[model samples]
Target: MNLYLNLPSYGTIPVVNSKNQTPNSNVLTQITSTTSPFITKANGNITIRQSFWQPVPNVIRYTYKYLGNNQFQRLHTDPHSNLITNSNFPDTVFSNSVTYSGRLIGLILESPHEEEYHSILTSMIPIAPAQSQNATGGVIDREIEKLLEIFSLQQVAIPKTFQTDEIIHIVILNPIPYQTSLFHIHQRALKGTYCTLRNNVWKCIWNIPNVRSDFHSVLNRFSSNDILINCCTSQLQPILHTWLQNLPHTSAPHLLKGHHPSTLKMKGRWYQTIN
Candidate 1:
């Protein structure tokens, strides 16, 4: 099931640990320190010599490819799925289709675990389908303003305090373009495969590197602007119906047109952040 939320301008919410626990800073710290001796950092930027595959999300969180039959079936993502998964099953993934498993790197744009919020109460009031469907980017902002006027609503919550409590920069290594990068997933790649084997399957499943030794730096670091959110298509009527019955204003959130991963051009070093 998809857990990430994509918001315009504000940026989409990255995947969070279950129950919204903060991602462990210690884990990132340890990995970087242990590997620092081998990495050369200049001007706080670690340069890259070789390109690497970064994990990104497909629609939903699984990577897939359609067989010649055009049927979405489990195609093998890599030859070593049997190894890292330690099962005869074909779904376990150790790394993306391009490299061995390692946590994504995000440089410290903001400190991790610096503080925590009890909750964020964002009430998404719904609008007519025609009006909602027409909204995107800045247009959505204007629609919200209109809704606020109609409803006499001013803010999402009281005692307003905004905190950019999340975000860190991982020195994204030599990242290839968005079209051919690795995807982020847990059980499988989202939707169907990339329609091609190399685009869908892990190219270096058996040749994953030791973080301390194998990482190659990039000439520059990736910024939040380089991050792109990915989504896929699914019939959401059931969930939308449920939300209309249970959520605020007797309505569910609006959705944009969802295209398959094969059609998306989400940029490199793609990783989601929790909002």
Candidate 2:
């Protein structure tokens, strides 16, 4: 698993440790003596990297194809009976067919755990549906405005508190792109010549990855223009859903989309319709 963080503007830094927690007298002195290494320094520019697998809906899109019947099956005298015959059990031929698996896209972004309150409150209000809201007009404009306020504030605070110009940004990627990357599962099946020769029938399964390495390549970076708060598809809007749904009901939030991960589970927030 990989954790990628992008710092939008990270000029270098002369970093010092905040303070020591509980520690023995000798250990405390030793830790303080250790020098803090300085890596890359930016003026406010940082790249982003890191990855985490979220159990997202619609992880894949699937389609299947059918292959025509085998020649032996067509020629068999007893059509319903087994295809294997004394002379051709080993010689049976078959055509290969395939079906496409699914594809998933993920994003990585950063938020201040502290200032997350206002957006948390606002996001609960929910988005209007695509048709009703007609996001190109005023309604969409208002939502985006609110979101930018929250995220921009967080961006500004990061450098001031950390004494570094860099801050973390989101990095999204699919860790396992194909079924061949999955682990294997084995099971018993009715005995056939090939089955008799083998211990068991084995199948492969792919579980989501804990993290992917591609997230690291873009660490600590984002474009100032790209960091809009209330924008529809990019960073803030999706994250608001993720965070609000995770919060407690004392928050009393509403949602804009019935399809949001939280709303699907039946929660208290108002459902926003995205027009």
Candidate 3:
């Protein structure tokens, strides 16, 4: 039997080892151990079944169909479907479409008598990518400014070598409550993760972690994972300032905040205030 596996550029697929293969004959015999990679044959043709271990990024429910071998000709039929409502989504806002395929194999590797049987089951699923949209142009401006600084010489100390394989895209999400999330999102974008920030919303392929101790420590108290941390509007400013002050160097936080016209320091560098 031929086994086929496919995934998106960002996803990974795992193949099962052949230790579980069993033979056709023996009326009642231990074909193979669960942990074992090799299977034993009982009679002539044995049918083995298996399932995928994990769900892909945007996979929802999937349908599997396949063809069966017959005396005269091969018979095709619809077998079953696997539903993934139990699988966890990284965030409440994200959705996606993903599909995976599984099949039985006949390879004995070292066994001289190994035979293969093809399955009649295949799967297809559709899922939505996590998404969010901002209605406020003011929010969009905040987003554009952030992007500018992201690409700015002062903000990006390291030079980015251009590569055709790199995918660069920007998307703005509404309801950004904490600066910690912004810190992570920015780091991820630099590393090739597409992310966008607007006045109130935020979205991305994945939340990148903040390497900066100031931001990382705060997030660690709540969640170590890169999900958005929602904060009340009333607490936004104070929390942001607190986090900014905790950064390794006072200048970094100030620069992040001072990007706004109203927040720009007047006379000297803003780092003096922290000293």
Clash number by candidate, in order: 29, 73, 36
Give the better candidate number (1 or 2) by lDDT: 1
Off by over 4 Å in 1: 1-193, 196-207, 210-275
Candidate 1: minimum summed lDDT over ten consecutive residues — where? 110-119
Lowest lDDT 10-mer window, candidate 3? 105-114
**What does candidate 1's lDDT look like per residue over 1-275, in tens digits?**
22222222223233233254432343223323433222233452332111222221111111223222213232244454332232112222212334322112221110000011111122112111111112221222222223222212222221212112222111211121111211211112323332221122221121123321221222112222222111221232232223223423221222222222222232111111111
Write down the lDDT that model 2 would get: 0.21
Alpha-carbon lDDT, every model? 0.22, 0.21, 0.22
Model 2 misplaced stretches (Cα beyond 4 Å): 1-142, 152-157, 160-211, 220-275
Question: lDDT tens string, model 3, 1-275?
Answer: 21112223323222222342221222112222222222222343222222211122212211112221211111222234332232222111112122112211100000000011111233222121221122112232233333223333234331332222222212112122122122111122211122112111111111223222322332222111111211112223344445434645321311222221112332222212111
Assess candidate 3 and give its TM-score to the true structure.
Answer: 0.20
lDDT of 3: 0.22
Decide which is better by TM-score, 2 or 3: 3
Task: Give one digit per residue, the lDDT tens place, for model 2 in 163-273.
Answer: 122222111211122111001111122133322211110111111112222212221122222221222223224543464345333323122222221222322221232
Question: 199 in model 1: Cα distance from truth in Å?
Answer: 5.1
